[model samples]
Target: MMSGLSRSCAVGLLAAATLLTATACGSGTADTSAAPGGGKPEVVAAFYPLQWLTEQVGGSDAQVTVLTAPGVEPHDLELGIPQVTEIKSAALTVYVKGVQPAVDDAVDPAKSFDAATAVTTIPAGEHAGEEHAAGEEEHAHEVSYDPHIWLDPSRLATVATKLGERLAAADPAHAQGYRDRAARTAAALGALDQEFAQGLSACRTKTLVTAHEAFGYLADRYRLKQVGITLDPETEPSPTRLSEVAKLARAEGVTTIFTESLVSPKVAEVLASQVGAKTAVLDPLESKPSGDYVSAMRDNLKTLQTALGCTA
Candidate 1:
């Protein structure tokens, strides 16, 4: 997260470098040329999950570039000159609007697709609007609704359908290819959603206490309750909040306290100890996992089954 002055400074620097950095962003995967008429549309994805989905839907017909690199927290991303250029030049940019403030500022409305618009969004977590440390305040989750819609495979399937349409509209030459791939991707996501439904149909506990509130959509999809230690991954919960969650976890018989790779686990570990629960990793898909989206989500399903004592 960036402070007000730092964010303003970043915006000014980005504007200053717009004409200078004509090359593409270099930190992540190979940068695709953002030039016109390559027989493939150049697309920019804001982060990992969006990157994976864009690759799945775009297939070989479109050139996709991801802004956030592997293992980098999306919220903390500060746009470089090249990335700003990439977003401006790309035919389309796929992103969740509230996740990355930098990307939100850089993207063109007419060219970019905000994934949150594709689904019915839930309210932002209780702590979302609260004032935080200087840098954390007014960062991610400042919006009225949560933007982590990709957690629900069903919602992502909807996004796939819409993205395919968007891509087809952008590059009408490969319209059939885009639509076909989108349908296939949607079918695959539907299958994954079914697996989650059946796998978590009968869990021992419905309450989910996580390090952060990134899983709200997933909880909504599967009818589980998410009690997050904090709203933003960058925000630290107060001792009072921790104690409150610990007491609630004990009452709900929560056996696991979930954490993620990008965020520190100290708070989760302490809360787990206080509640006599074990700690487990629950990837929010904010960053690239060891495996791709489908495989990583399947891994999450297995983790949830074990943690929640699901029959499946």
Candidate 2:
């Protein structure tokens, strides 16, 4: 899939780079079209990750509708009335606050399971915000967090707990089921976190270069330094910036440049070739994944282990 970031890099490549909206990348592919049970209420997710969470926690008690289509970049998403209707009519709507500006405009903040409410985020402009000042200092080191919270399993587990409660409230008949599912999902996420800690514990290098900045949470969680080729999905970095990255890539001995399943690999390919490094697919879980959340994440774990040369 051609991700918004890759597209930006292709055309914009440091010249008047544009910023990609948070939804620019579609996430994991899960079976979201499952038939609802009798009285199984409707739950509308803003994107793939939310859809996956609701699907897992809600199980058979809810019918999840993900607004983002496969292969479609969610960034700069201009939603129509039909999609708005889906959100307005659903028994519950869950989304990240800053992920899709369109969703924020259409959905009521008080009623939705907003992930931004639960997780600390990087400064708005760090990734999705459009008002970031353009200058040489924009790339300076900072402690701001990115909004891709689900990349960190512990944060996602927190979201699952809160979303499960919301589901229970919406579907009283299956309240216990919702709670149980949340507990199980949290346990699984916890185990995944443990695996990552153990797996990445002995990596030869703690640096990761990705096509976009979606891995902030993941890198932070796993103690890896992330160098993104395109942090702003809509715009490409400046030539000066690219040159700096290329130089840093050489200095860091960064051997891999990762593209994603949802985004275009062209930018990574170009950059990898420039750096004399190999390209790999490091999914950020941005699309309607071909597999469920756990499987998708496990695949990511294996890829990370291999790419980072983890001992475990």
| TM-score against truth, every candidate | 0.86, 0.80
Residue 112 in model 2: shift from native, Å? 0.9
**For residues 1-312, what per-residue lDDT tens digits would candidate 2 score against the true structure?**
999989888887545433332122111112222224334677888878888888889887787888887666665566898888667656778987656768778886545777767766644323322223342135333234466888889889888888899888877778999999999988888898888888889987788888777788888888898877666465466666567668888898888888887676887788889999898888777676778777888888888888777887
What C-alpha RMSD separates each model from the true structure?
A: 9.8, 14.8
What C-alpha lDDT, on a 0 to 100 scale, does residue 85 get in candidate 2?
A: 63
The lowest-lDDT stretch of 10 consecutive residues in candidate 1 is 23-32
The C-alpha lDDT values of all candidates are 0.87, 0.74
After TM-score superposition, what is the CA distance of residue 244 in candidate 1 from its true location, in Å?
0.6
lDDT of 1 by residue, 1-312 (tens): 899999999999998797445433322222334444354678999999999999999999898989999999998999999789778778889999888888889989998999899889999766522323422455634577888999999999999999999999988878899999999999999999999999999999988899888999999999999998887777777777887888889898999999999999999999998889999999999999999999999999999999999997
Off by over 4 Å in 1: 1-38, 128-137
